[model samples]
Target: MQVLIANHGAYLSGIATTLWLCLYSGVLTLVVGTVIAGFRVSPLTPLRAFGTAWVTVFRNCPLVVVLFFMAFALPVLGLNASYFVFGTVGLALYTSAFVCEAIRSGINSVPAGQAEAARSIGLGFTQTLGLVILPQAVRSIIPPLGSVLIAMIKNSAIAGAFGVGGDLYMTGTRLSSAQGEAVVPVLIGVALGYLVITIPAGLLLGYVERKVAIAR
Candidate 1:
Protein backbone atom coordinates (compact mmCIF):
# COMPACT_ATOMS: atom_id res chain seq x y z
CA MET A 1 0.00 0.00 0.00
CA GLN A 2 2.82 2.36 0.80
CA VAL A 3 4.60 1.64 -2.43
CA LEU A 4 1.43 1.97 -4.42
CA ILE A 5 0.45 5.24 -2.84
CA ALA A 6 3.95 6.63 -3.19
CA ASN A 7 3.86 5.89 -6.89
CA HIS A 8 0.20 6.75 -7.33
CA GLY A 9 0.77 9.10 -10.24
CA ALA A 10 2.92 6.63 -12.10
CA TYR A 11 0.52 3.80 -11.46
CA LEU A 12 -2.48 5.83 -12.48
CA SER A 13 -0.78 7.07 -15.63
CA GLY A 14 0.18 3.56 -16.59
CA ILE A 15 -3.32 2.26 -15.96
CA ALA A 16 -4.81 5.10 -17.95
CA THR A 17 -2.55 4.47 -20.92
CA THR A 18 -3.22 0.76 -20.78
CA LEU A 19 -6.96 1.36 -20.63
CA TRP A 20 -6.75 3.74 -23.59
CA LEU A 21 -4.84 1.23 -25.64
CA CYS A 22 -7.12 -1.60 -24.60
CA LEU A 23 -10.26 0.35 -25.47
CA TYR A 24 -8.85 1.45 -28.81
CA SER A 25 -7.66 -2.04 -29.69
CA GLY A 26 -10.88 -3.66 -28.55
CA VAL A 27 -13.05 -1.36 -30.66
CA LEU A 28 -10.87 -1.86 -33.73
CA THR A 29 -10.84 -5.58 -33.12
CA LEU A 30 -14.64 -5.67 -32.97
CA VAL A 31 -14.98 -3.78 -36.24
CA VAL A 32 -12.41 -5.83 -38.07
CA GLY A 33 -13.72 -9.02 -36.61
CA THR A 34 -17.27 -8.16 -37.62
CA VAL A 35 -16.19 -7.52 -41.19
CA ILE A 36 -14.26 -10.74 -41.39
CA ALA A 37 -17.17 -12.62 -39.83
CA GLY A 38 -19.42 -11.20 -42.54
CA PHE A 39 -16.99 -12.27 -45.21
CA ARG A 40 -16.70 -15.76 -43.81
CA VAL A 41 -20.49 -16.08 -43.88
CA SER A 42 -20.88 -14.55 -47.33
CA PRO A 43 -21.51 -16.65 -50.41
CA LEU A 44 -18.66 -15.10 -52.37
CA THR A 45 -15.76 -17.48 -52.69
CA PRO A 46 -13.08 -14.81 -52.76
CA LEU A 47 -14.40 -13.16 -49.65
CA ARG A 48 -14.51 -16.47 -47.86
CA ALA A 49 -10.98 -17.24 -48.93
CA PHE A 50 -9.73 -13.89 -47.75
CA GLY A 51 -11.41 -14.23 -44.39
CA THR A 52 -10.17 -17.78 -43.97
CA ALA A 53 -6.63 -16.78 -44.75
CA TRP A 54 -6.78 -13.87 -42.32
CA VAL A 55 -8.04 -16.01 -39.45
CA THR A 56 -5.59 -18.79 -40.21
CA VAL A 57 -2.56 -16.57 -40.38
CA PHE A 58 -3.24 -14.47 -37.32
CA ARG A 59 -4.72 -17.14 -35.08
CA ASN A 60 -1.98 -19.62 -35.85
CA CYS A 61 0.87 -17.17 -35.28
CA PRO A 62 2.08 -16.03 -31.87
CA LEU A 63 0.93 -12.52 -30.98
CA VAL A 64 4.45 -11.53 -29.87
CA VAL A 65 5.74 -12.58 -33.26
CA VAL A 66 3.10 -10.44 -34.91
CA LEU A 67 4.10 -7.52 -32.73
CA PHE A 68 7.75 -8.00 -33.58
CA PHE A 69 6.97 -8.11 -37.27
CA MET A 70 4.87 -4.98 -37.03
CA ALA A 71 7.50 -3.10 -35.03
CA PHE A 72 10.54 -4.26 -36.97
CA ALA A 73 9.42 -5.36 -40.43
CA LEU A 74 7.04 -2.50 -41.04
CA PRO A 75 9.78 0.03 -40.46
CA VAL A 76 11.93 -1.72 -43.00
CA LEU A 77 9.05 -1.48 -45.45
CA GLY A 78 8.96 2.31 -44.90
CA LEU A 79 5.85 2.37 -42.77
CA ASN A 80 6.97 3.48 -39.37
CA ALA A 81 4.36 3.94 -36.70
CA SER A 82 4.95 4.80 -33.05
CA TYR A 83 5.53 2.07 -30.53
CA PHE A 84 2.11 2.57 -28.93
CA VAL A 85 0.41 2.69 -32.32
CA PHE A 86 2.21 -0.34 -33.65
CA GLY A 87 1.67 -2.38 -30.51
CA THR A 88 -2.04 -1.58 -30.38
CA VAL A 89 -2.46 -2.24 -34.09
CA GLY A 90 -0.75 -5.60 -33.87
CA LEU A 91 -2.76 -6.60 -30.78
CA ALA A 92 -5.99 -5.56 -32.47
CA LEU A 93 -5.25 -7.48 -35.65
CA TYR A 94 -4.18 -10.67 -33.91
CA THR A 95 -7.05 -10.63 -31.44
CA SER A 96 -9.54 -9.75 -34.15
CA ALA A 97 -8.73 -12.96 -35.98
CA PHE A 98 -9.97 -14.99 -33.03
CA VAL A 99 -12.87 -12.61 -32.49
CA CYS A 100 -13.81 -13.10 -36.14
CA GLU A 101 -14.01 -16.84 -35.62
CA ALA A 102 -16.14 -16.43 -32.50
CA ILE A 103 -18.51 -14.04 -34.21
CA ARG A 104 -18.63 -16.22 -37.33
CA SER A 105 -19.67 -19.16 -35.21
CA GLY A 106 -22.40 -17.03 -33.67
CA ILE A 107 -23.54 -15.97 -37.12
CA ASN A 108 -23.58 -19.56 -38.33
CA SER A 109 -25.80 -20.44 -35.39
CA VAL A 110 -28.44 -18.07 -36.78
CA PRO A 111 -30.97 -19.63 -39.14
CA ALA A 112 -30.55 -19.14 -42.87
CA GLY A 113 -34.31 -18.83 -43.22
CA GLN A 114 -34.29 -15.48 -41.49
CA ALA A 115 -31.98 -14.03 -44.10
CA GLU A 116 -34.10 -15.57 -46.83
CA ALA A 117 -37.23 -14.07 -45.36
CA ALA A 118 -35.60 -10.66 -45.20
CA ARG A 119 -34.54 -10.95 -48.80
CA SER A 120 -38.06 -12.01 -49.77
CA ILE A 121 -39.27 -8.77 -48.25
CA GLY A 122 -37.15 -6.84 -50.83
CA LEU A 123 -34.19 -6.23 -48.53
CA GLY A 124 -30.75 -6.22 -50.09
CA PHE A 125 -27.95 -8.36 -48.70
CA THR A 126 -26.51 -5.54 -46.58
CA GLN A 127 -29.91 -4.54 -45.31
CA THR A 128 -30.75 -8.09 -44.40
CA LEU A 129 -27.48 -8.45 -42.55
CA GLY A 130 -27.86 -5.14 -40.80
CA LEU A 131 -31.51 -5.49 -39.81
CA VAL A 132 -32.08 -9.19 -39.39
CA ILE A 133 -28.84 -11.13 -38.98
CA LEU A 134 -26.27 -9.04 -37.13
CA PRO A 135 -28.47 -8.11 -34.19
CA GLN A 136 -29.09 -11.72 -33.29
CA ALA A 137 -25.51 -12.63 -33.97
CA VAL A 138 -24.29 -9.82 -31.72
CA ARG A 139 -26.54 -10.87 -28.91
CA SER A 140 -25.27 -14.42 -29.07
CA ILE A 141 -21.65 -13.27 -29.22
CA ILE A 142 -21.61 -10.83 -26.29
CA PRO A 143 -20.28 -13.26 -23.71
CA PRO A 144 -17.52 -14.65 -25.90
CA LEU A 145 -16.52 -11.19 -27.07
CA GLY A 146 -16.26 -10.12 -23.47
CA SER A 147 -13.80 -12.93 -22.89
CA VAL A 148 -11.81 -11.74 -25.85
CA LEU A 149 -11.73 -8.24 -24.40
CA ILE A 150 -10.28 -9.57 -21.16
CA ALA A 151 -7.64 -11.52 -23.04
CA MET A 152 -6.71 -8.44 -25.00
CA ILE A 153 -6.30 -6.45 -21.80
CA LYS A 154 -4.00 -9.08 -20.33
CA ASN A 155 -2.01 -9.32 -23.55
CA SER A 156 -1.42 -5.60 -23.58
CA ALA A 157 1.19 -6.25 -20.88
CA ILE A 158 3.50 -7.34 -23.66
CA ALA A 159 3.56 -3.80 -24.94
CA GLY A 160 6.20 -3.16 -22.30
CA ALA A 161 8.61 -5.47 -24.10
CA PHE A 162 8.13 -3.51 -27.33
CA GLY A 163 9.23 -0.22 -25.76
CA VAL A 164 5.75 1.19 -25.35
CA GLY A 165 5.60 3.32 -22.22
CA GLY A 166 2.80 3.92 -19.70
CA ASP A 167 1.49 0.38 -19.52
CA LEU A 168 1.08 -1.16 -16.06
CA TYR A 169 3.72 -3.76 -16.68
CA MET A 170 6.17 -1.17 -17.89
CA THR A 171 5.57 1.01 -14.90
CA GLY A 172 5.98 -1.96 -12.62
CA THR A 173 9.25 -2.81 -14.29
CA ARG A 174 10.51 0.70 -13.80
CA LEU A 175 9.56 0.76 -10.16
CA SER A 176 10.87 -2.69 -9.44
CA SER A 177 14.17 -1.99 -11.07
CA ALA A 178 14.52 1.38 -9.40
CA GLN A 179 13.71 0.06 -5.98
CA GLY A 180 15.71 -3.18 -6.41
CA GLU A 181 12.98 -5.19 -4.75
CA ALA A 182 11.93 -8.79 -5.46
CA VAL A 183 9.06 -7.68 -7.73
CA VAL A 184 6.29 -9.32 -5.66
CA PRO A 185 4.65 -6.06 -4.78
CA VAL A 186 4.92 -4.81 -8.34
CA LEU A 187 3.30 -7.94 -9.67
CA ILE A 188 0.56 -7.78 -7.08
CA GLY A 189 -0.16 -4.16 -7.90
CA VAL A 190 -0.33 -4.89 -11.59
CA ALA A 191 -2.61 -7.85 -11.04
CA LEU A 192 -4.97 -5.77 -8.95
CA GLY A 193 -4.98 -3.06 -11.56
CA TYR A 194 -5.93 -5.57 -14.22
CA LEU A 195 -8.70 -6.96 -12.02
CA VAL A 196 -10.07 -3.49 -11.60
CA ILE A 197 -10.99 -3.52 -15.27
CA THR A 198 -11.58 -7.19 -16.02
CA ILE A 199 -13.71 -8.17 -13.01
CA PRO A 200 -16.37 -5.57 -13.75
CA ALA A 201 -16.29 -6.42 -17.42
CA GLY A 202 -16.87 -10.09 -16.65
CA LEU A 203 -19.72 -9.31 -14.28
CA LEU A 204 -21.36 -7.02 -16.82
CA LEU A 205 -21.12 -9.66 -19.54
CA GLY A 206 -22.59 -12.20 -17.18
CA TYR A 207 -25.46 -9.85 -16.48
CA VAL A 208 -26.01 -9.34 -20.19
CA GLU A 209 -26.07 -13.09 -20.77
CA ARG A 210 -28.64 -13.57 -18.02
CA LYS A 211 -30.81 -10.80 -19.40
CA VAL A 212 -30.57 -12.21 -22.92
CA ALA A 213 -31.45 -15.67 -21.73
CA ILE A 214 -34.43 -14.38 -19.83
CA ALA A 215 -35.65 -12.50 -22.90
CA ARG A 216 -35.38 -15.64 -24.97
Candidate 2:
Protein backbone atom coordinates (compact mmCIF):
# COMPACT_ATOMS: atom_id res chain seq x y z
CA MET A 1 0.00 0.00 0.00
CA GLN A 2 2.82 2.33 0.86
CA VAL A 3 4.35 1.50 -2.46
CA LEU A 4 1.26 2.86 -4.16
CA ILE A 5 1.68 6.08 -2.25
CA ALA A 6 5.37 6.34 -2.79
CA ASN A 7 6.77 8.59 -5.51
CA HIS A 8 4.00 11.18 -5.05
CA GLY A 9 1.30 8.47 -4.97
CA ALA A 10 0.91 7.85 -8.66
CA TYR A 11 -1.73 5.19 -8.06
CA LEU A 12 -3.83 7.51 -5.93
CA SER A 13 -3.48 10.15 -8.60
CA GLY A 14 -4.61 7.63 -11.20
CA ILE A 15 -7.68 6.82 -9.14
CA ALA A 16 -8.48 10.52 -8.99
CA THR A 17 -8.16 10.72 -12.73
CA THR A 18 -10.47 7.76 -13.09
CA LEU A 19 -13.02 9.51 -10.91
CA TRP A 20 -12.72 12.64 -13.00
CA LEU A 21 -13.16 10.67 -16.19
CA CYS A 22 -16.30 9.06 -14.81
CA LEU A 23 -17.68 12.41 -13.69
CA TYR A 24 -17.04 14.16 -16.99
CA SER A 25 -18.18 11.26 -19.12
CA GLY A 26 -21.24 10.73 -16.94
CA VAL A 27 -22.31 14.36 -17.36
CA LEU A 28 -21.77 14.23 -21.10
CA THR A 29 -23.74 11.01 -21.27
CA LEU A 30 -26.61 12.58 -19.37
CA VAL A 31 -26.78 15.55 -21.71
CA VAL A 32 -26.47 13.55 -24.90
CA GLY A 33 -28.88 10.91 -23.70
CA THR A 34 -31.47 13.50 -22.72
CA VAL A 35 -31.33 15.01 -26.21
CA ILE A 36 -31.57 11.64 -27.82
CA ALA A 37 -34.44 10.73 -25.53
CA GLY A 38 -36.19 13.89 -26.61
CA PHE A 39 -35.64 12.88 -30.18
CA ARG A 40 -37.00 9.44 -29.50
CA VAL A 41 -40.15 10.94 -28.06
CA SER A 42 -40.50 13.88 -30.43
CA PRO A 43 -43.64 14.31 -32.49
CA LEU A 44 -41.51 14.63 -35.60
CA THR A 45 -40.95 11.38 -37.44
CA PRO A 46 -37.51 12.38 -38.70
CA LEU A 47 -36.31 13.15 -35.21
CA ARG A 48 -37.59 9.84 -33.90
CA ALA A 49 -35.94 7.95 -36.71
CA PHE A 50 -32.65 9.69 -36.09
CA GLY A 51 -32.89 8.95 -32.41
CA THR A 52 -33.65 5.30 -33.14
CA ALA A 53 -30.64 5.11 -35.41
CA TRP A 54 -28.44 6.70 -32.82
CA VAL A 55 -29.52 4.22 -30.22
CA THR A 56 -29.24 1.27 -32.56
CA VAL A 57 -25.70 2.12 -33.60
CA PHE A 58 -24.23 3.02 -30.26
CA ARG A 59 -26.04 0.57 -28.00
CA ASN A 60 -25.29 -2.52 -30.06
CA CYS A 61 -21.61 -1.75 -30.36
CA PRO A 62 -19.08 -2.99 -27.81
CA LEU A 63 -17.60 -0.42 -25.44
CA VAL A 64 -14.08 -1.53 -26.37
CA VAL A 65 -14.81 -0.98 -30.05
CA VAL A 66 -15.97 2.54 -29.37
CA LEU A 67 -12.98 3.19 -27.14
CA PHE A 68 -10.55 1.85 -29.73
CA PHE A 69 -12.12 3.93 -32.45
CA MET A 70 -11.76 7.06 -30.41
CA ALA A 71 -8.33 6.27 -29.03
CA PHE A 72 -6.65 4.79 -32.07
CA ALA A 73 -8.68 5.31 -35.23
CA LEU A 74 -9.39 8.98 -34.63
CA PRO A 75 -5.73 9.67 -34.08
CA VAL A 76 -4.99 7.91 -37.34
CA LEU A 77 -7.52 10.15 -39.00
CA GLY A 78 -5.64 13.26 -37.86
CA LEU A 79 -7.68 13.89 -34.76
CA ASN A 80 -5.29 14.63 -31.96
CA ALA A 81 -6.88 14.49 -28.58
CA SER A 82 -5.39 13.06 -25.43
CA TYR A 83 -6.19 9.51 -24.46
CA PHE A 84 -8.19 10.82 -21.53
CA VAL A 85 -10.31 13.12 -23.71
CA PHE A 86 -11.00 10.54 -26.37
CA GLY A 87 -11.67 7.88 -23.76
CA THR A 88 -14.21 10.06 -22.03
CA VAL A 89 -15.89 10.95 -25.31
CA GLY A 90 -16.11 7.32 -26.33
CA LEU A 91 -17.53 6.40 -22.95
CA ALA A 92 -20.09 9.19 -23.14
CA LEU A 93 -21.22 8.20 -26.60
CA TYR A 94 -21.55 4.55 -25.73
CA THR A 95 -23.21 5.08 -22.38
CA SER A 96 -25.48 7.76 -23.79
CA ALA A 97 -27.40 5.12 -25.71
CA PHE A 98 -28.27 3.22 -22.55
CA VAL A 99 -29.06 6.43 -20.75
CA CYS A 100 -31.36 7.48 -23.57
CA GLU A 101 -33.27 4.25 -23.43
CA ALA A 102 -33.59 4.34 -19.67
CA ILE A 103 -34.89 7.88 -19.78
CA ARG A 104 -37.29 7.09 -22.61
CA SER A 105 -38.62 4.21 -20.61
CA GLY A 106 -39.13 6.60 -17.76
CA ILE A 107 -40.97 8.91 -20.11
CA ASN A 108 -43.20 6.05 -21.11
CA SER A 109 -43.92 5.29 -17.50
CA VAL A 110 -45.60 8.70 -17.28
CA PRO A 111 -49.38 8.50 -17.56
CA ALA A 112 -50.62 9.19 -21.06
CA GLY A 113 -53.55 11.08 -19.58
CA GLN A 114 -51.14 13.64 -18.22
CA ALA A 115 -49.89 14.52 -21.66
CA GLU A 116 -53.47 14.79 -22.86
CA ALA A 117 -54.27 17.09 -20.00
CA ALA A 118 -51.27 19.26 -20.84
CA ARG A 119 -52.25 19.39 -24.52
CA SER A 120 -55.85 20.26 -23.68
CA ILE A 121 -54.53 23.12 -21.60
CA GLY A 122 -52.81 24.54 -24.72
CA LEU A 123 -49.38 23.24 -23.88
CA GLY A 124 -47.07 22.28 -26.73
CA PHE A 125 -45.28 18.94 -26.88
CA THR A 126 -42.07 20.43 -25.57
CA GLN A 127 -43.88 22.19 -22.79
CA THR A 128 -45.75 19.06 -21.83
CA LEU A 129 -42.61 16.97 -21.72
CA GLY A 130 -40.52 19.59 -20.03
CA LEU A 131 -43.09 20.58 -17.46
CA VAL A 132 -45.46 17.68 -17.06
CA ILE A 133 -44.09 14.31 -18.18
CA LEU A 134 -40.35 14.33 -17.51
CA PRO A 135 -40.58 15.53 -13.96
CA GLN A 136 -42.77 12.63 -13.00
CA ALA A 137 -40.78 10.22 -15.13
CA VAL A 138 -37.65 11.12 -13.21
CA ARG A 139 -39.00 9.58 -10.06
CA SER A 140 -39.88 6.29 -11.67
CA ILE A 141 -36.47 6.03 -13.31
CA ILE A 142 -34.25 6.82 -10.38
CA PRO A 143 -33.21 3.22 -9.71
CA PRO A 144 -32.41 2.51 -13.34
CA LEU A 145 -30.63 5.82 -13.67
CA GLY A 146 -28.52 4.93 -10.67
CA SER A 147 -27.68 1.60 -12.30
CA VAL A 148 -26.63 3.35 -15.49
CA LEU A 149 -24.27 5.63 -13.62
CA ILE A 150 -22.76 2.74 -11.70
CA ALA A 151 -22.22 0.96 -14.98
CA MET A 152 -20.56 4.04 -16.35
CA ILE A 153 -18.11 4.14 -13.48
CA LYS A 154 -17.23 0.50 -14.02
CA ASN A 155 -16.99 0.90 -17.77
CA SER A 156 -14.52 3.71 -17.36
CA ALA A 157 -12.00 1.00 -16.59
CA ILE A 158 -11.82 0.27 -20.30
CA ALA A 159 -10.12 3.60 -20.75
CA GLY A 160 -7.19 2.38 -18.72
CA ALA A 161 -6.44 -0.39 -21.17
CA PHE A 162 -5.93 2.21 -23.87
CA GLY A 163 -3.32 4.15 -21.92
CA VAL A 164 -5.55 6.75 -20.42
CA GLY A 165 -3.36 7.94 -17.59
CA GLY A 166 -4.45 7.99 -13.97
CA ASP A 167 -6.97 5.24 -14.47
CA LEU A 168 -7.84 2.74 -11.76
CA TYR A 169 -7.02 -0.49 -13.54
CA MET A 170 -3.85 0.86 -15.07
CA THR A 171 -2.79 2.28 -11.78
CA GLY A 172 -3.52 -0.97 -10.01
CA THR A 173 -1.46 -2.92 -12.49
CA ARG A 174 1.41 -0.55 -12.02
CA LEU A 175 1.10 -0.71 -8.28
CA SER A 176 1.08 -4.49 -8.36
CA SER A 177 4.24 -4.59 -10.41
CA ALA A 178 5.98 -1.95 -8.38
CA GLN A 179 4.81 -3.03 -4.95
CA GLY A 180 5.31 -6.78 -5.31
CA GLU A 181 2.21 -7.56 -3.21
CA ALA A 182 0.92 -10.07 -5.71
CA VAL A 183 -2.24 -9.35 -7.71
CA VAL A 184 -5.24 -10.16 -5.52
CA PRO A 185 -4.80 -7.39 -2.98
CA VAL A 186 -4.11 -4.85 -5.67
CA LEU A 187 -7.25 -5.88 -7.55
CA ILE A 188 -9.25 -5.91 -4.32
CA GLY A 189 -8.10 -2.42 -3.60
CA VAL A 190 -9.18 -1.44 -7.08
CA ALA A 191 -12.62 -2.95 -6.55
CA LEU A 192 -12.92 -1.18 -3.22
CA GLY A 193 -12.06 2.09 -4.91
CA TYR A 194 -14.91 1.54 -7.34
CA LEU A 195 -17.29 0.70 -4.50
CA VAL A 196 -16.31 3.89 -2.80
CA ILE A 197 -17.65 5.84 -5.74
CA THR A 198 -20.60 3.67 -6.64
CA ILE A 199 -22.07 2.87 -3.23
CA PRO A 200 -22.36 6.48 -2.20
CA ALA A 201 -23.80 7.46 -5.54
CA GLY A 202 -26.43 4.78 -5.33
CA LEU A 203 -27.36 5.77 -1.80
CA LEU A 204 -27.60 9.41 -2.76
CA LEU A 205 -29.82 8.67 -5.74
CA GLY A 206 -32.04 6.54 -3.60
CA TYR A 207 -32.36 9.36 -1.12
CA VAL A 208 -33.34 11.73 -3.90
CA GLU A 209 -35.91 9.29 -5.20
CA ARG A 210 -37.52 8.99 -1.80
CA LYS A 211 -37.47 12.71 -1.30
CA VAL A 212 -39.23 13.30 -4.61
CA ALA A 213 -41.53 10.31 -4.57
CA ILE A 214 -45.16 11.13 -5.21
CA ALA A 215 -47.66 10.50 -2.45
CA ARG A 216 -49.29 7.16 -2.67
> Largest lDDT belongs to which candidate?
1
User: Candidate 2 clashing pairs?
Assistant: 14-166
Per-residue C-alpha lDDT of model 2 across residues 99-138, encoded as one tens digit per residue: 9999999999998999999999999999999899998898
lDDT of each: 0.87, 0.86
* Window of ten residues with lowest summed lDDT in model 2: 2-11
What TM-score does each of the candidates earn? Answer: 0.94, 0.90
Model 2, total clashes: 1
Off by over 4 Å in 1: none
lDDT of 2 at 133: 91
Pairs of residues at least 3 apart in sequence or in different chains that clash in candidate 1: none
lDDT (10s digit) by residue, model 1, range 86-204: 98899999999989988987887789999999989999877887789888887788778888888998999986679788788888888899777558877788888888878887898
Query: What lDDT is reached at residue 210 by model 2?
Result: 83
